[model samples]
Target: MPHPATVVPEIASHLKRLLDFVDPLPGDVCLDVARGRGPLPALLAPHVRSLTAVDAARDGRAFRTGPVRMPGDALTAAPAAPHARADETGHPTVRADATALPYPDGSFSLVTARFALHAPDDPHDVLRELLRVRRPGGRLIMADLVRGNLAATSRDRIERLRDPDHPGIPTIARLTEMVTAAGGAIRRLDVFTVERPAEPWLADAPDPDAADRVREELLDEVDGGPPTGAKPRIIGGELWFTQTWAHVLC
Candidate 1:
């Protein structure tokens, strides 16, 4: 079995902010794109009528009492409550790619992609797909890292070194443009920064040497101007860096 993830303060705060931005309605049928381990699904289930969480990989483990199942092309074929007897949460997990959702167009009342935008091979295509799945006038929300111009280029380089699957983080302006191009009008936008500890953040890096190099670069910026544009600082004897997050609604 996979170990339970510890919810760090930074992540918790961000999730809270995202929830606030989304303000899910009780009648809304929501879809969480790239929802790994189902944090967003758990939080959203109470507010939304039904929640479907999708990820690229098919994991055997259930998340927050929801059954993990292979995604069907037709959402209508799935039972209204797949785990109604076993679990009251009633949300379902589906294995599918974000760039091409399995559900038909206008299937959901609300669609959200949080913290997973940077991992997609084609974020633009994924955003378009997300829009396609939403019903007319339904809300589409996205929350992800926004790169500042000062460190945008270098940040992408360091992130790719840390995670080979990392596509790249775009600026807030870039994200807005993508959303607009995907047939979404801006409803709301909230921008904030989170300070994350360096060690824990780098612990998951696949390449140790690359992690070290990225660490050195971040550390170098601690005393001077931040190199990657994320403000690096020493707080309470821990090396911390900032990442800007944008909660956008369309």
Candidate 2:
């Protein structure tokens, strides 16, 4: 796991931005749908009545310790930690699939899912499930990776190479349509770009050799081999790419 000391500030910024969509009440109960773990408790606990953290993944999925998250298959060996555990965050935690949460309808005043939508076969299934659990007039927010203007086929190709579980990241329009189709309304939308190095991001790939292959492919894109939608570039002689993220508030 990555040391919490160096990464917390950046993670905190990402999460606080997610919280900006609503006027949070102290009495509101919140659910954080995480694929992995991070500093959620330290950041989100103080804002709500109660917070429950859950995920379908049992092992190294992307770590969404708070709101901003790595891709589901991004880091295996370098997840941000210390805040990853519920006990440490002092919140109830459950091991459950996002598409089939055990909670009843209208159970929570708030639901926040980060970096989890792309894993399910149909993201609409997870969205509907999230909407089903949220109370009427309550807040529902989700953050996900948004693919760039490049060829989605190349992007999906490399994402699957790292972890086969990833169903390609969505375009902004497609994502909003999924939300609306699932009976959620988009009250506000926030999009941002995060530029990160390719090395640390791929350090914990499920297959080490696969990581090398992905690196080659991304570099190939940099060398004009193909458009990957990853928008790879070299920064200080290191491979880097910008990931677009969207926070959809309903």
Q: Which structure among the candidates has the greatest lDDT?
A: 2
lDDT of each: 0.67, 0.68
Query: Which pairs of residues collide in model 1?
Result: 151-228
Model 2's lDDT to the true fold? 0.68
RMSD of 2: 6.4
- Looking at candidate 2, the ten consecutive residues that score lowest on lDDT are 72-81
Off by over 4 Å in 1: 1-7, 57-92, 149-152, 223-226
* Candidate 1 lDDT over residue span 51-170, tens digit each: 877754334321111111222222211233442222223334466777878888999999987665665347778788989999998988987778654445877777777777677778
Residues 112-152 of candidate 2 have per-residue lDDT tens digits of 88777877446799899999999998888877787644436
